[model samples]
Target: MNAASLLHLLQFASPALPIGGYSYSQGLEAAIEEGLVTDADSARAWIVCYLDEVVARWDAPVLWRLMSAFAAHDAGTIAQWGGCFLASRDTAELRAESVQMGYSLSRLIAELGVADTRALGEDVTLPLAFACAVDGLAIPHEEALLAMVFAWVENQVLVCVKSVPLGQVAGQRLLLSLRPEIERAVELARRLPDDELSNWAPGLSMLSMRHEVQHGRLYRS
Candidate 1:
């Protein structure tokens, strides 16, 4: 990637991008409450599964499709994959999180003259909005996917640290261990077809639903 593209990716992936990622754990907090992720090891395991089963298999591939569609200026494909992304969310909380992040990023991009989400309507999924921004910024597909996964890894690790009460080192350790996996996930995501995109995470889905009703909550999803 060129320096300009690299800088755009960095800014888009930064934790301070203000897309409200820190507000949701995507069921991590509920897992902690249920004693499923009590320490660093358990937290790491859960993150790996989520990254592989949920994120890599579903979002990353969808993101790849969205990036391609955006590059081609195919609005129909963009909307199709965007709907697929939102529909894959198992619970209301999960769906809302994606929508909210999508709206935020899309609005920001529009305001900055990057991409016009108005034509795409308001209920954009995060993957599409993010992909649109990268496409608008002329970021390469591979780098954009890496940036997206890296952002997710960073956000989820911080979630574990705050919700599971893991140490800073533990969080950093999890990030380190997931680095190779992230790259592999991006590569696999690139190769995946629309039919191969799966959202099979019953455990995560159950946790997400349980979290919506759980008394003590630390996250939005």
Candidate 2:
């Protein structure tokens, strides 16, 4: 990647990007409420499991395919995979979270003249929108995927720190420990074939579904 693409990649992956990632736990808040994650140790386990199971096996592969589609300007393939990703959301809140953030980033890309999101149509999954931005910014796929997973790790750690009331230092420790797993997840995503892609996280799915009715929640999913 050139300096410009590298800078754009960093900007896209930064937590400061206004996509409302801080507002959602992606099921972690519910897990914490249910006592599944209570400390830095448990939080680390929860996040690692998510990375190994869902993100490596499902999200990254879908993101890879979407990026390829965007690079090829294959609109039909983009829609196909985007719909699959949206449908894979295990709960209404999860689905809505994807769509809401997707819309936010989509609009941001359009307004900034970064990408033509109109071709993505009315409904956009986060991965699809991100893929669009990566194409527009001329970011290399490998590095973009790495930043994407790392950004997710950072956001999940933030969620744990806030909701579990863990210290910021503990959160930082969690991020440090998760580096290898993040890299491994991205590597797995790179080689994962389409037939083998799966999002079979019943535990997470159940927690997300129950989160919809949780009495008082800090996150949308």
Candidate 3:
């Protein structure tokens, strides 16, 4: 990847990118409320399963395919994938969280005058918008995929730390241990087909649904 593309990937993946990632725990809050994740070990397990089965099996591959579609300037494919992404989320809060973040990121990209902004438009999901931004910047597929997955893991780790109250050191350690899983996810993403993208995290989805009406909550989803 060129330096510009690399920089774009870094910026997109940054926690400070202002995508409101901190506001949504991606169901971690509900998991904690239900005691599914209470301590470092349980948190690590939850994250691992989530990244491997949920994220890898679902979002990563969808994002990768969306990147290809964006690179081709295929609005139809983007919209189809966007619908699938929206449908995959089993809760209203989760859907709102993703669309809001995506819309915000698209606006940011437009204001920044990033390439292919016209193709990206204002209505896009967070992951699809992210893929479009990086692909538009001409980042190599492998590097972009890896960076996105890493950012996702980092974000989930931060959420776990806050929700489960894991120590900073423990959180970092959990992230370190996920390196192999990250590599696996990247590899799986590369091989996944566009037609076979699906997510099956019933437990996580259930928590997200339950969280929408949760009497007391610290995170949005």
Q: How close is candidate 3 to the true structure, as a TM-score?
A: 0.93
Q: What's the lDDT for all of these models? A: 0.86, 0.92, 0.82
TM-score of 2: 0.98
For model 3, state the Cα shift of residue 27 in Å.
Answer: 0.7
Off by over 4 Å in 2: none
Ranking by TM-score: 2, 1, 3
The CA-based lDDT of model 1 is what?
0.86
Clashing pairs in 2: 27-221
- Candidate 1, residues 1-221, lDDT tens digits: the string is 78998898888888898889889888888888899998888987888888888788888999989899988989898888888887787799999999999889888998889876777776888887898898889999898888889888888899888877878987898899888989888888888877788989898889989999999787898
> Which whole-number lDDT from 0 to 100 does residue 220 have in model 1?
93
Of candidates 2 and 1, the better by lDDT: 2
How would you encode candidate 2's per-residue C-alpha lDDT over 1-221 as one tens digit per residue? 79999999999998898988888999999999999999889999999999999999999999999999989989899989999999898788888899999999999999999988888887788999999999999999999999999999999999998999799898898899998999999999999988999999998989989898998887888
Deviation in angstroms for 3 in model 2?
Answer: 1.2
My TM-score estimates for the predictions, one after another, are 0.97, 0.98, 0.93
Off by more than 4 A, model 3? 116-123
